[model samples]
Target: MLYRRFARPLLFRLDAERAHELAVSGLSRGWRALPGVPKEDPLLAQDLMGCHFPNPVGLAAGFDKYARAVAAWPRLGFGFAEIGTVTWRPQPGNPRPRVFRLPDDRALINRLGFNNHGAGRTAGRLARHRRRGHLGRVPLGINLGKSKRTPPEEAPSDYAESLKHLWPYADYVVVNVSSPNTPGLRDLQEESELAGILDALAAVNRARAEAAGSAPLPLLVKLAPDLEPAQLDAIVDLALARDLAGLIISNTTIAREDLASPASLAAEAGGLSGGPLRERSTQMLARARRRAGDGLVLIGVGGVFTADDAWAKIAAGASLVQVYTGFVYGGPGTARRIADGLAEYVHRAGLASISAAVGTAAEGGA
Candidate 1:
């Protein structure tokens, strides 16, 4: 009630990007003052990728392109939080007016181009948080993206560089090959293009873990929602072959089909995320699960806004689900709302654990 009636209208009044800046600032500076995030119901817990998620809902990457407010995430009720599509080099993202809201559709279209303070700078900040023992409550994932100016063939090293700087701080690291905003970024999703990137990351992952006398940090990939069937199959095959930790089922979609928003906002050139993307994203999650079988873990994203939406993703095969646009519209209480709702569903369905619910709605699922 507070967010919808009081915060949403005020946030909606500003330019979308400007409003995002304010929210980030507020969360970063005032986390300690915020009420403590309560423990999730036991049914919501899941252990995967060697980490225990207090709940299956995570704040998606791109929402916090920097670690500025990272400490606030678990406190705000997210089971985990991913920061950045941070690149090897810093670049001013596309132009202003790059982010727009579609209230009717409850979605966001962003062409922000992975703008961030760059890997080294962000690693430094996270290090400060680490030194203060503020880096953990829930898992932290660092999402790595290619430098916009880096050549396509060199994307492997480009992504690897960011990982090198940021890995120490990540509970897991995600290779972001999706995002419609960056020119040719999506192309990196191609098996040929992606194999090299994964290999580079794996090499660094092992070396770092060995140096630290710990297990290699889990590594996952984020993909775009617009991929064709064959493309998804080949990519899943490749991921299993390379032994990736998991996959973030999707990023955002370029297609604007079936939106309630006006054509002007719908036609904006970027990825469409939120209510409009739920169906396709869940469908893709099921497909990937089928291909990987028990060999891979999946994290579903795109258009999740409520317990029902998140549950659908899990039943479709996501071990966990993430929120980007949903958080934008659902506001601060989003995580708790979704977690509470999911617990109700778990009891209603008579499930032993939420993990057992994975892929239940799909053919040959759990």
Candidate 2:
């Protein structure tokens, strides 16, 4: 309440990126001050893609671009933190005025262009974190994508290279074929192209699993929200056929029509995320559930600002849900509040388990 009434207004006055840095730095400092995060009920615990998570709520990728904030985030009640979309090589990304806030619509538009400190640097940082015992108990995933200079034909090798570097540290790996800010990145979602990319990654995963005497890594493909139903179906079929783990339903959208922001704001060139994206992401989750059948694990992310929003995603076919803009809009306690609220929602609805409610709202039952 204090944040909604005051802190946010103060943060909004500064340049968005500057404000973001300050907030992250402050959180890191505060985590050092506290003893540790408090324990919570097991109602929030879950298993997805063969790994167990203490809770279903997670901080989505892009929040901690290079794993700098991993230790502190677990204190904030995130069951997982996906750090990156890190490329094989680091680049400066887009110029300033790249991030914009649409307060009227409770949304954000960004053309950040996958800026990161490279996967190798990120892995080095994470390895150090492990040595320092900063990983906490929360699971971590790494999202990988193509560097700006990389061409389409070479994209698979680029992603594979990143995987080779990051796989040792990442509990899971996300193939980021989405993101509107990157030119031609979404084209990787094309059936033939996507298959080739996954095939290459799968081959590497098979070798790695054999070496470790374990099962293949949990590999997920993040999709763009703008895909048509047929495209979604094709991707779902591909996921199952290739034995990939799951899908992260809906990445930031290139669509501006659904946003309630002014025409001037909508004219901005970038992906729009947050409250405006809720329904569509949910709709996409339902679609993926239906097409992928009962087996695919869906991580729903888009406009989850409240517990109800999280419940809506759960009931529409998401096994787990993620947030970024919602956390920014709702303050530090946001993830805990959402997780608590979800458990309450489950009890009130008399569902035996959260899994029981998956896809209840939309008929696209998972």
Positional deviation of 354 in candidate 2, in angstroms?
1.6
Candidate 1: segments with Cα more than 4 A from true spot: 364-366
Stretch of 10 with least lDDT, candidate 1:
357-366
Model 2, runs deviating above 4 Å:
364-366
After aligning candidate 1 to the native by TM-score, how far in Å is the CA of 138 from where it should be? 0.6
* Most accurate candidate by TM-score: 1
What is the C-alpha lDDT profile of model 2 across 183-277, one tens digit per residue? Answer: 99999999999998898888888888898898888999999999988999999999999888889978889887665678998888998999888
Relative to the true structure, candidate 1 reaches a TM of 0.98
Q: Highest lDDT: give the candidate number.
A: 1
lDDT (C-alpha, whole model) for all candidates: 0.90, 0.86
Cα RMSD for predicted model 2: 1.7
> Which clashing pairs does model 2 show?
317-359
